[model samples]
Target chain A: MNLAQPIYARVKDHILAQIRSGALVAGSRVPSENELVSQFSISRMTANRALRELTADGFLSRVPGVGTFVREATPRTSLIELRNIADEIASRGHHYSSRIEDLREMMATPNLIDDFELRATTPLYHIAIVHEENGMPVQFEDRYVNPFCAPNFLKQDFSHQTPTAYLLSLLPAEELEHNVEAILPDANQQRRLKISSSEPCLSLHRRTWSGGHVVTSATLIYPASRYALYSRTSLGKQTS
Target chain B: MNLAQPIYARVKDHILAQIRSGALVAGSRVPSENELVSQFSISRMTANRALRELTADGFLSRVPGVGTFVREATPRTSLIELRNIADEIASRGHHYSSRIEDLREMMATPNLIDDFELRATTPLYHIAIVHEENGMPVQFEDRYVNPFCAPNFLKQDFSHQTPTAYLLSLLPAEELEHNVEAILPDANQQRRLKISSSEPCLSLHRRTWSGGHVVTSATLIYPASRYALYSRTSLGKQTS
Candidate 1:
């Protein structure tokens, strides 16, 4: 390491330690360029480098004319991992269960054909389930399965085990596509989740594929106040 | 195509078309199982299946005692795609420009070493640039670069091109990890973005790597009222 390396790192570490120690809370402004230079006995250029880098990494916020300040951190959740809702709930030490709202074997429409990549008028299975954590409804899962992927889907009862678990056990996929977002809940969701009309909902949309076949596609909705998604990634790891 | 397939698909398509066409607006209650059964002239089981699947797909919301309603169609935005803010502004026919608030080269700390998977005390470059659209500040971009990835990072001028565009030209990676969430902007962000304290901000966190080398990581913050993320996916093919 060069002589300048230690000085630069110490300054960066000092700022991060203050953040972790809560000496600097979210939205609180930090010292100016001149102040940092004087405090660290470093050149103005080096002080500027530390603050600028921190801002880019999301630890600090900078505005022109105004000084820099600490930033509130947002949870970084991964969408690629295909985890079951029941398992996710159970992992948190909460009792998890699902109520089978509806289930049936049916034929596909043009859209379903397109969505599931099925031949015209192919047979498919549909299921509706509300997964609960600690007796509270947390996820409304609606899913469609290509019958070819799980021929005996309707024979299995979902009350004891979720469709996700059953399918993951029966067939596992190598590739998956995931999408997630938030929006206002509708009257029905508001009532079913026991939330009000004003509450927002976090929604997840996912599709799984294996061997050039579409296994299943599902949309899961949750009351925002009750649920959150989380994920972690190493630096330079492409997350798609 | 089997007889059951057309019936299953028509009902699903009709409902989605209605929602997309705005015939069924957000928050409006959808027809009941009984109503759908009568309108579609299919078995009650078929109508039930359609509504059940739609609800699971996030196109509808259902309550036990109340009724089913159209879910607010919130678009899911993919974080993996690196979007250019300036291009986004230009697409909207607005003039976009950026001001270089701070830019300098520095040495990496322990955290950076772990994050970028680098040896202790490596040299790195850091840059902070606030992007504006039509004279209104919209994004605060903070970035860190592994000098090993882009040796001449500091030599490039950012007054004209964003670091994102610059990096994209230098290293194109096959994989990406992206995280998006809502947060309260700090005092510095509020001042630079010209947003009031009452408004929330949407934060997009991204980390990109190529061939196991950490290129860059960034967190882009935008005021909530002005921005929303959008994404879509499809089930392409079914394989047995």
Candidate 2:
């Protein structure tokens, strides 16, 4: 630790280091204010300041009654709106429909645990739905839900509504984070989307949060030939 | 025109047909209220309703004192927020720099004309800049500016400032549109980004509108290995 740096900044860096090194995983509680103060030999104010700043920076999530925990690094705040595919198709005067390919309760794998910030072997709701516009597949949505966020997730009939819509009703989303990627889909996705392997896909990874807990994480695959992910710059200070 | 449709709906469809059939290009003036009334044998109210609806739907841009004209079809509202690359690098505590590869005034190509919603052969300012973080190339930004939006665009030296910064200073953008794609970059883009053909590039196409005119159009290419576009969804009613 650099003695010249502020005590709070140093404390913040220490927790950040643990996160970077994977010593602390998502959903794992951080050292409390008292623990940090004693361990770092810092004042209570300094330790508190560090934790507060980390939460503001999206590195930590402090539950009101619960303890502060590491946030899933990939699921930061979203800059893109999570629009329902049904609404997008309906806006264009097209018939919108969805076929649920898979919806089941499964044990969380390592990947799912990391994405949902849950413990290994936690029961998660896995769903795969293909959204169609005018009888043509346009989007293949694969999603996983944290059982804690929606305890009745696996019981819902998804054909009557989208998973997103159902989750929003349980707890209105307060925050969203997204990543956009382009790749060639696998055989299953290619077959479902009716696109050749040569065609590129626009994949959108989205995570939603409500009440300081991760609601769900999803990867939506779209045929680049038909759909696009769009956003605009608002008038304000240009900051990342 | 379908007789069952409303008068304004029929009028809107007729103009939409002309635009679809290539009879009306971007920036081409739509028929005036009087002309539409006379040509379509509709009342002034019906003509006005059709024009207003088209403008609201993004098919037309209406200048306050001037006539309404067709919009570039692809530049619809964005779903992602555009952030300055410099800020993104800076937030990571890394040095950010940009190298100006090309900056010149050129006659608009057919594609450029369509993108800018300008007349054929209209002069546009073209710029290509490579943004680096810690001296490593991360983004290759190719842009075209409407001379009408920034008449003195050629006079600025971008080495000291970013094109985005300068453009925002000229006109505070009122609207933004973006399309995100994943693709194999061309030879020039590959050379600038210092990536190989096997590497996929995340390409972001953007357009800005202010005062009812397109200010600029740009394609920002980044190596997927080095960079990703991220956005946070704001809490609101989800709409394009």
Candidate 3:
């Protein structure tokens, strides 16, 4: 701890470091001001100021009656740019993992064929995976890849590499289309995401194109309670 | 309409033109296949192609046993950028209006003082507005302005110029921070937006800074059923 800063500033930094180190996680209770005061041998006012500043800065959320808790690092809104979940989690210095629910060859429906500009009933690769950050599920990714775009898509080891990373390695996408909606999750989605029926989800419908051919289509769903899509751009640029 | 393209292509262009011209609005039914066939003196296949392709391209949405409707022009996920709603509606050629619910000076609460970095009880401008696109409510903007930054904030006519527009004109923002969440709206928000309780909303919490001073903080809410946030950017650039 730096001796230059004020007592309250140092206390704020201490709590922030704990949050950054993952010793504190979202929804976990923080130490009460009395505890901080006792530990640091500081006045109660200093402890209160530290906690108040952190809450104001968004690192913590305080319920009036209940105690303060670590705020979930809200996921950046995926509306602006396509981001890989594994990368996002890793950037936060958290553990990243995925549960592969299904990966197999499937016949493209008429609608799928239209999307890929392929003939009817063509073979396509389908994959469904649940992405986790620090062992907690955060996103359920359901995806379909055109066989014509990547024939060996099913053979990739997705446990170590994300589908998004793998696909981008195959070819950097030239164009991308996105649709973001807040929806009530289906029972299956709810189960996979470990969310209740009352909880809505932010569902992102996305498609990527490479070399003038549709490469993949995906539906990524995040439980509203766990994540919030975020973006920052110049004004007048449409963003959710 | 250009005569060079195929008849069905022309029909598709016609509908698109109507949408662009604001003759057709979101949730409003599009001309049925039979109606298009009769109007254009074309075969049913051509009419069907036009509607089907439009649906596929996202300009329209179809429902069985009901009819096709003009899709809500999904706000481009300004993941890479922040976009103004008034500009978006104007670009679509739709009539844009705002109902100012509240615009007055108010004392900053403890939390507001922290957010604005002001002394407690400092006068701040607060505004509550419902923005409409083609006479349909789309966004409810609840904003608080730092009077220290814009002293004449309340003097501006918000109807002719949006708060965003007004603020932006005062000074180009140096930085913007955004948090986007899908939430179940409160009863007051539900009534103002004219949406059902079951419907979720995309809520955006945004703050802007200019010249190293906090300019504004706002909560913008959009009904999930009526609006979908969208964005398109290069791969790997994180967006909401």
Candidate 4:
């Protein structure tokens, strides 16, 4: 009856609302394509499309010749090791958003020069981004780049393309060095992530090397309570 | 000279003391073998063996033409990815210690039977251990095992060796499942780890599979501030 929204969206939302609100539990059969078509006065194709998309997005699982059932809500988590954060979130069928908090060119500091082995006078590009999933901020990324490694670094709209994606699109890193640490968040981090001050944070520091040069050094901070890196796939090198 | 300690240990202690105390900084060359042989009135082989052991232990880097120099103090961290914790710490030249908190044979709970897909009323082996490094506690391990998988599970002395080492010795896992989470320390965990209650802990859960069965499920928890997982080695898949 809501004419403002499209018919397909309205139908999808009506079914999704039931699933999310626990009206339809996992393994419970969803409305059949015919039932949906007749109940909503929608075409058969529209009902099929809604179910198909829902299955693709992991909301439902369809058994051939049988009916579709609500699925368990545990999303397959991202492979967080040196992965592009945007692509990782998108793969799980979640909305991905980024806020470019700071981006500018600055002279390489002593620590950068020492760690990155850059010349003292070499100018560097610094970028800070807050990445969110479904409107909740999860990670804060602070990255520094070597100008020679990525020229024209400052011109792009990061909202459209992430810095990591753009960098990989230009050239994949030959080597990645990663270090993970746990720390208590400061006041500013608490505000940015909207987490409690007592929250512990997992800080992942990564160095990307390309063409025998340190291309970029990034520090990604995540509220430990909100997110974690997980893996379950096997390498297939089995014993026994 | 202290008569109680052996000569080689004295020589090693002297050199190590300087390096650890920052009396000799990184890249600073140590006294030559001949000079050590004369200064301590020791044999040529004693000096050579001490230097060689130091190089092997990562305290010094020896160049063929140049003399041995104090190395950077950053120890190559243990590969924490389902690695044998004892070997990992040994590889980093640190003392590894484990306290067996609890080990017993018990009936599998409903949750364990559900998560592990075991038959109800099956007996399970439960183990709790606190792993320490350099006299500091770092990780607390809680584990459950299917007795049919490792029939002699209760006989091993975990103090001399780790439970992981024993399980892996019997049969290498065909599949491994890992999940990581962050949580504030509970009173029990804080007491076991000797960490403040406010500290956040990184909890890694692992399931090891063999012969299409989950042999062991382990929950390893570490105080975030004290230890971290680090890697600087390359995978060697080149780009650019």
- Model 3 collision count: 18
Give lDDT: candidate 4, residue B230. 63
Tell me how far the alpha carbon of residue A230 in candidate 4 is from the true structure, in angstroms, after superposition. 0.9
User: After superposing candidate 4, which stretches have Cα over 4 Å from the reference?
Assistant: A1-79, A119-121, A238-240, B1-81, B91-94, B119-121, B238-240
Worst 10 residues of 4 chain A by lDDT: A73-82
**In terms of TM-score, which candidate is stronger, 1 or 2?**
2
Task: Write down the TM-score for model 2.
Answer: 0.62
lDDT of 3 by residue, A131-180 (tens): 99898899999999988778999999999999998888887675577777
Q: Arrange candidates by DockQ, highest first: which order?
A: 2, 4, 3, 1
Candidate 2 error regions (>4 Å)? A1-79, A119-121, A232-240, B1-82, B93-97, B110-114, B117-121, B134-136, B234-240
* Per-residue lDDT of model 3, residues B36-148, tens digit only: 98999999888987897788667898877799999877555454344678987886777899999999999988888877766557888999999998899999999999987
Candidate 1 residue lDDT tens string, B67-91:
9998754332233457678888999
Summarize candidate 4's per-residue lDDT along B26-89 as a digit string, tens digits. Answer: 8999998989999999998889878877885668988776788988765333333447777866
Q: Best candidate, DockQ-wise?
A: 2
Worst 10 residues of 3 chain B by lDDT: B231-240
Chain A TM-score relative to the true structure, per candidate: 0.64, 0.69, 0.64, 0.63
Can you give the lDDT of residue A62 in candidate 3?
A: 83
What is the C-alpha DockQ of each candidate? 0.04, 0.22, 0.19, 0.21
